[model samples]
Target: MTPEQNRHAAQLAFVASGAELNIGTPEECPLPVDQLVATRGDEPYVRERFSAGLTAHVYRIHAQGQDWTLKLAREKCKVQNVDGQTSFLNEIQRRADLRHLKHDPLLTDRLSAIVDTRYASFRHGVLLSPWIEGVAIQAWDERQLLQLFDTLVALLLGGLFEWDLCTGNTLDDGQVRLFDFGYMYRFDPLRAFNSNGTAMPQFHAAERFETRQYFAHLLRLEQDGERLALDAFTLEKRIAVEAYQGLRAELASRGAAPVVLDWLDGIIATWKRALVNDVSELYLQEAWRSHWLDLHDDLSGQTCTPSTLARIGWLERTARERYADVQRLVVVESKNRLFDQLREARQLAQRWQVA
Candidate 1:
């Protein structure tokens, strides 16, 4: 069939299959993969992949003329929930609304236009956006790391600012770039006060521990007796940990990970001592020094130290165990809740048709 004919057929099939129709002309929507490929004569290469949080297959297209990412949703059936599609559309609308806002030099730039393709499949939708390039802030080098922390603090304290300021959502080139604004909100003092009631913002213990490792690395980059630029990182880490600890404690009291709660409390104590005493810089310096001293001690055979290989193995095993538990729980819950809802809807529709 011709390109237009093929698209028309797809649209008809989607509608017949009971997919919700999107409000837009065909030209406004993202063309089918075949149509897109046919239109792009020799521009960029396209590779389809999937991300952890998406039900859609994502296509990363690289062209000298055009660089963009395309996501096409998987086909849904009567037994499948389309909440993912709804969430994607909501996120698109939110991003579009904030597209005109002046972004911090640290945030990733997103394109304003969202190409919707709700008629692409029998029960799915599609979206397209520009692909950003950079390593995550967690993986940045010392110079990049300093800039990243600075940028984060500036963004947070500038005005009413709210975004998931986690390591995963931050990217760094020479400067930091905040991405994934799906949970962005305006920072309200009232809300903050109501939530924590005079508690300072802090990092979760896990985040603090992870960031401490990064800080140690940064300390190593400096010469002897030279101070590392870590004021913002230290402050933000403390804030995030405090917030995380409070949340974790609440969860733990309800029979969550009590072990994690204890660990977080210890970390919080450490941060309080370091920050309140204005000795955070010294604390990081000492931690790094102790680490290097232990390394030297290991080399001198004072004790049989765990090799890097052994440490990695331990970490991998721990991750696997936790992930398996999480995966099983998620799969069971999703099937019971989301899939059941869809199945009930389909049964209702069938009964109505029969009546």
Candidate 2:
């Protein structure tokens, strides 16, 4: 089939399957393919096949003389009561908002303008936006990797904290542009604490909570100071710390050195101070401050050796030990609580039996 024909068929099949068709040309049964080509332009070249996604088939296209990616909902996903319309609108709004926020230095540059539309009888909803181009932050080399982390920390403190910043979500394009703002929120550290001592920010709550937890874990690791023996009480936290430490170890083994590790330590320390001060900008400033760059320079050209790798392993093992200790403590406390509850239950049962 001609490209235009295929585009028409895709749109028709999408709408026929009950999708909330949002992007297609009207007045045609299957929608004209020429219209699709005209709408998107002929630059990036339309991907002939759909790219597999979690809930939809995405197509890479050059739309309006720019590199764009489009997503069309799968027919099977268009269930009754599914608010596909609302979701489509919300996504468009969110993308628009993101484009506004992209002007901030912390955000990645916008690749293509987001377009939301429906054509003809196409039922499936469509989302078109600029395709982000860059390497995943987690895939960077040691020096570049450390720099990426520094950028993330800076962005977090600079009022763009996504609460969901992780290895999986960050991309490096000279700087980091965080994607998946479905849970993005603005956070104020000072105004975040509730009466119960819980921190509640208006952003991605779960992600924020996890980030705080991980930071707290790091603080605990620092406090341990020496190679401390692990107990059941600290096992879980230790394990969490070990996971990060192990990752660091792997990176070091691949060529990261003491100076880079030290730079990381400084970043962690600055982050801790920022957390304590409830000031995000302070952390960002520290990340880019003169002293930090000097440290970066000092670490430059340093490569991880076998000795450093061994040291990282030792650090990870120590963290694991602490985790074991913490876990044991938790288990003991749980048992004690359970025993008390069981005793009370037995007493209540005895009284009922007697009655």
Clashes of each: 13, 38
Model 2: residue 103 alpha-carbon error in angstroms: 5.7
For candidate 2, lDDT tens digit of each residue in 1-355? 6332453454445435764423323432122344343433233366544432323455666544555555554544321222222333334434555455546663442222212232322333455545666565423333443443444333333333343333334556665545443223333222222111123211222224223222222324435642221221133223323333443454455555464455444544543454455443432232122222222221221321232222233333433444344343232234345345434533433333210
Q: Tens digit of lDDT per residue, candidate 1, span 125-204? A: 54555565556553344455444444433333322232223344555544565544433333322223111212433332
- Candidates' RMSD to native: 17.4, 18.8
How far does residue 59 in candidate 1 sit from its true spot (Å)?
2.2
By summed lDDT, which 10 consecutive residues of candidate 2 come out lowest? 193-202
Off by over 4 Å in 1: 1-45, 48-56, 73-90, 103-124, 136-138, 146-168, 185-355
